[model samples]
Target: MNRIWIPMAAAMIALIGAAQASAHESLWIEAEHLDGVRGYCWPMGRPKMKTTAGHWGLSGPGWAAEWNMGGESGFLSIATGADDDKAVATKTLEIPTAGRYFVWVRYGDWREQTERFQIQIQQAGGQPWTARYGERAIVEEDNEMKLYWDWVFAWDRHEVELQKGPARLSLASTTKERSPRQVDVIVLTTDPSYRPRIKERPGNHAWEILQSYRDGIPDGLEPLAKNRPNFNLPSQWKVRTFRNKDFLYLWNVSHTKPEETWLGDKPDRVKVPYNIIDKETREEFEKTYGGRDDVPIFSDPRIVPTFHGVGAGIFTTDPKTGELLEAGKRFAAWLDADPNRNWAMMMNYHPGKPIGEKGIQAFRKYRDRFVGSISGESLGYFYPDAKAMQQATA
Candidate 1:
């Protein structure tokens, strides 16, 4: 059983507020939201830093103060050194005007070893400017935990210019010592005297909205973990009733034929579309086991299409002539032909070489027919093509 929690309404409100705010007042960017990460932490082979959401007991933010005080999502953390070390996270933002901006970083000062890191600012297409920001000492909080793990004024002595148009900001690991460092948010402001208040944290409003939803409808959108289907294959199903949509995902589609097909393109390379059982096979299986009390209805293999293998597989190609297959198009057309049905799909391109521009274009061509957008596992793996698709659709 699988479930996903998506706070769409609150997230949209936050985005609108940020977009309308004047850049000079102050700009807040959550560390977790920052992109262009280069690291080896996640098993997906990208975003070296680990992301934490909600709360975790025993140490860090919760051990000191209320965890929600930081932001909507928790934070991005990294422990540098050894084979798992070295990570840099960067984000590009549009600078409203050219001027000097004061930089402040909010981080968990739970350990001294992970206290500091290098910060850089660069105008798009220009060389990066580095600053030797001194080590920030923890400010003793007047609380029982006595943990002042929040924003610290960084690069106080230098003028970090905010170039007009797109500019990049980066936070990188500086030491080879393996110690956890948690970063909640990063702020850039034109006012040197500016200080961040807990109430002004990025996700406070979203958090309040989420609380309202929870309080108003206690069981409105609780996880359907136990109600999920088990088709004997790995899959992910996301339900967003507020938007009247369902996102179904399946990957690594393997087939029964081992000796006749191309299986060694990449280790454990799974093919696609082929993983979907034929209509006759599905009907026969259903006839045999459909309504039996021993088997759940959702467990039926034909409920929603799923890919069972993970490797380089042909989405729409013929092995004999390399001609494109029309089965995927036919399936998508069948789904879209019905106006009353609201369905979306998510597909993975792990090792991303299999799905290129053509695959992304096919998704964009059918975007309007679906209620929800396509999603990926890792930003590093599909962000380039995803960005292109988004731009084209926009």
Candidate 2:
């Protein structure tokens, strides 16, 4: 939980007929899930990096939160840009009350903004939040970048009835504040799902899972570790799986509150919205936890986070006695999520100089002696996503 962010608008416009809109369908929620839902704020057709010196932001791509009917939900930004047209922009969400609800909107590619945009839910509100049945004002748009509507149930109770104390859900304004060009992206998906269970995670990961890495690792620690990748894509990659089809994820958020509200008018403040998952389905989550080999590859949290924090320490490297790579006795990285993106995370390790559960039981005895191949579920595994592997191996 660092600070919190969600700003960037320029242009977006696209809304026609709507026969079930499709951009390969969109939805994601990962940052260790299975309950304990936290960050959730959709609307990211890529859009980060405004001046990392000239372009470099929006790392991982995993946002859109609010499940379990808590509060706050609504998104949209953008108001400029137009090399030709496809630069309209939209933001709408209103469910003052109804009941069984769910919605998850996500967009991507930010650098001011510009894409086939248009999202609606035009008229309907007030009551307990009545607005279901084909969703009154329920408009949708995707343009073509993938990730448009991952889930939208709406059983109808009044539409989404809910009001007690300080409840919230918006989208339908008259301009109390509108500038970022004029409004490009914005959303409000009422708890698309709701689960809750949390445990792992202990240190590190306040943010930055691979920012600049200092141009080229001027020896930031041991040897390799240059970083400066992701937005470039290299240092190991692969691809396949129906060529992926579509996706436009974006991440680089923070929020656990930022001074309490307003979001400081601008200037790249904090950021939030972790969670990320999508790739058709992600091989049913590596056959439900890599089939389980006593399942101790750092407790199978995709090999112990390495990023995103919570419990760490399970080093290895004994190539037949090459020695000096045995450190265990510490672990943490469990998260709970709900809002239709169902979630839970993993990662643990430890031993002599560590703490807690003997450092995850000494990384489960060096992962049952010798790491064992390694698997924690990453979908097709092509890995490549440092910007689509730099536009598919450039």
Candidate 3:
């Protein structure tokens, strides 16, 4: 009875999952499928009669795959030498039936405002109609640095009437620039409600939360065992011999590539120091350090590297004595030697700690030291008052 019921339950679950997935499938057309043709070929400028021009091939690497639908890598680029010189790339797309369709062009704009083009579309028996399209200057410096191809959603949607069979879409550069405009892909859908897939920029809080979760470290906790400093020490210094149990162990703790060390040689034959910890010491270390069994712990008195600008290290001593050497002594000395040294600490506080007056003061101190943005959801607690929160957000 149990076996029979289980099979029925599993089949029902599979059917529900299939229904949910099928709901997202929609009718659409990809630009790469359209036939491409150019008046002139490459090298000798031979004329070709095909739909697509090999001369105006795919754009820069990774641009087509990222912007174009169906992960296509081909695009049509038409440039004109002089204002009178005509260079048009025509793409022929076959339609099932004559109807109204929504059109979208995946394009980028890095040219001057005056350097624009006209998109001409011709139905089966109809004459060509043109639409002027151009891009405006980006005000943000960071957004301007992105490749023009990365602006997938920077296009406007236009409605076009088609009469079934085949339609000719042409892109002709109206400017005199050497390379006027780039068209990654043209998407046409019968459903007027359809919207092109685009990447949305995350807000400040969302971006902060995303970055916080990326390093696999818990919120408000620093990655202690990952990415150690490259000290470039001799091979002999890689392994240290201790009098207790006569065990050879590695000096560094790594989440992956445990055999690698700052000493530059593989500790293939050496046993891990954490695995060889005595039962009593292991219990004590776990109690003091919160017994996180997920990551390997270094059981030696060594310097744990950090990404802090001051080159600080977390110095750990004997677990039984609970001794921790001042972690930032080396960093302090380095800063003292050069008073003008620009350095800041990458701090990770306890997640459970309340965001109070002390936390706000600490955040301000860190913000002044670090010349850039300090991101983390943990910092949100520093703004307890409503006005302070508003000011911080602003």
Candidate 1 wrongly placed segments (more than 4 Å): 1-25, 37-85, 111-114, 124-127, 132-134, 141-159, 199-394
Model 1: colliding residue pairs: 252-308, 252-309, 252-310, 253-308, 253-309, 254-309, 269-311, 270-311
**What's the ranking of the predictions by TM-score, best on top?**
3, 1, 2
Write model 3 residue lDDT over 1-394, tens digit each, in one string: 9999999999999999866543321223333343453342211122231123222333332333343423322423232322322556677767665666666665544434333566788875678767766545432324533344333224555677777677777766555533334455566655554555442221233456678777786756766678877879988776653322233322223222222322123333232223223667645654544423233445242322222111121222224544432332333333355443233223333222233343344334333332331222122122267988789999
User: Deviation in angstroms for 271 in model 3?
Assistant: 12
Which regions of candidate 2 fall more than 4 Å away from where they truly are? Answer: 1-86, 89-313, 316-394
- Global lDDT of each model? 0.46, 0.26, 0.42
lDDT of 2: 0.26
Name the candidate that leads on lDDT: 1
The RMSD (Cα, Å) of candidate 2 is 27.1
lDDT of 2 by residue, 55-122 (tens): 11222222232121121223222222222122222222333443333333222222222222222233
**Candidate 2 minimal-lDDT segment of 10 residues:** 173-182
Model 3 is weakest, by summed lDDT over 10 consecutive residues, at: 304-313
* TM-score of every model versus the real structure: 0.35, 0.18, 0.35
Model 3 shows how many backbone clashes? 5
